[model samples]
Target: MPLGQPLRLGRHSVFPPLLMAPMLDITNRAFRTLVRGYGGCGLFYTEMLNARRLPTESAQSPFWQGLGVERDVMVQLLGDDPEALARSVERLLPLDPFGFDWNLGCARKKITHWGWGAALLENPQATARGLRALRQATDKPLTVKIRLPEHGHPDLFKSFIKLLENEGVDAITVHARTAADGFKRPARWDAIAQVKSWTKVPVIGNGDVQSAADAQAMFQKTGCDAVMIGRGAVGKPYLFKTIINQASGATEPAPEAAKVLEAMLTCLDTALETPKGAREFKVFCRYFAQTLPVPHWFWAPLQSMTLGPELAKRARVFFKK
Candidate 1:
């Protein structure tokens, strides 16, 4: 059928519940702005911000600079310190985001080494304390993005699910893969189905959804309340708009190469506004390059160009051909 229904997060409601998944280094202001410009994604997420550093992050830093592109965005936090996370939430309260989502799905070594993200799944006590702290920290909508249990940790996974509901999570977005599976394994959408059976909280299914058809299948098969698109949205910012329109029996014009080129450059220009923006622009291009006729041939060129104006000119030339 259609993508899925609108999702409620405490006091907030996001209609047409197709969400953009929280991707570190990828879901910045320029990228979210590009996706929102296309329309379809009901809710968006910031790159997972380190909770401890968030409270002290400079407003002028690249991280904070990109957060203002849209409203109805969720601030995703990563860390193990309850008190620090509480402070971070307090700082974000004034921004009036759609809500806050605690991340329990990242498997990155740098993060898990700190006993945060996916590592918390096996550490119930810490997870409970962190969740409880977040609940007490914000009156705004509070949620989480999580993974299935790790190998041989079935009991731990079940308890983590129970803990989420017990601690008052407004919603849970299941990445639908074990922490060990990483991206090397195809996503287990079936796992999302299982989470639906265990938790009463609204479930948003994420993983391997690259199109409207995939979203439809996830909704039908998992009975999830929403579908979240991650890497799939990188190449085509218009993918969400297309998915939403298809559900309505309407067709959206494929974004023109020139238009996509212009959008990336605009974001690059925005990135160039900050001292550290060049790195963000490069990270952004690695994905945007996928839209080019020959991604392999163009990625190096895109990555090599550092100045926004020069890159914009070259992009126009390359895309026009």
Candidate 2:
């Protein structure tokens, strides 16, 4: 079957319902722009910004710079402080993002120690209070991304999500693993379908989606409102187009190596616009390398170059037939 209808995020509607997942350092402006060129992704997310730190972040910091502001971008927030997050949302309101998503799926000890991310699974009351604070602060579409609770009955999980809906959350993206499970276990699509059955709010299923077929299967298997692409989109943004086409019952071959090289070059040039952009270029290329038919042919030289310009030049020469 073709992909479902447009997904409504409060007043906003995103067609095709394929989203580029909120990756910490990878989903910056340059990368989102590169993905946009290939088409299919309906929404882009900023790197998860620290809600408490956002007020103090410099206007020129990498966190604030080189972002795809033109697209339907969702600015994701990470933190446990309800008041601080409300303050941060107030500050961010002027940017006019399509929405905001709370990060409740990150399992890193550094974040969990602060009672944030996956740790919030242990304190549903905090999650409720934070969402209430955010709801009071803005009329923008507010959502949360979560891992399944590390310890909870299915009924408890359902009640927690019901609390989110009551607090005015526009949607929820479930990562399908419990906090303790991290990514070691396969994503439980069965559980995602169960979550879908529990709530009226649009559910976006994330995790283990690596290709067009996988995207199609996630939607079919889970009956989710959408599917999110994370690690899979790093090098293959065109993967979105593939999924979209396949979902529509049309088929398109993956892009040629030359086209992929051109998009990667564009990403490099865009990253070079900022101060530490060379490092950004390297990070993007590191993932972009994996998309190649024989990645090792280009990985060594890409890895050796430290300067963005040099990397771009070598990439051109290497990809040249």
| Top-TM-score structure, candidate number | 1
For 163-276, candidate 2 gives per-residue lDDT tens digits of 888888999999988766766888999888998998999999998999888988999999999899887888687889888787677877877656777776676565674546
| lDDT for each candidate structure | 0.82, 0.82
TM-score against native, each model: 0.93, 0.90
Candidate 2 Cα RMSD (Å): 2.5
Model 1: lDDT to the true structure: 0.82
RMSD of 1: 2.0
Listed per model in order, the count of residue pairs whose N, CA or C atoms clash below 3 Å is 0, 1
Q: Each candidate: RMSD to true structure?
A: 2.0, 2.5
Predicted structure 1, TM vs. truth:
0.93
Specify the poorest-scoring 10-residue window by lDDT in model 2: 62-71
For candidate 2, the clash count comes to 1
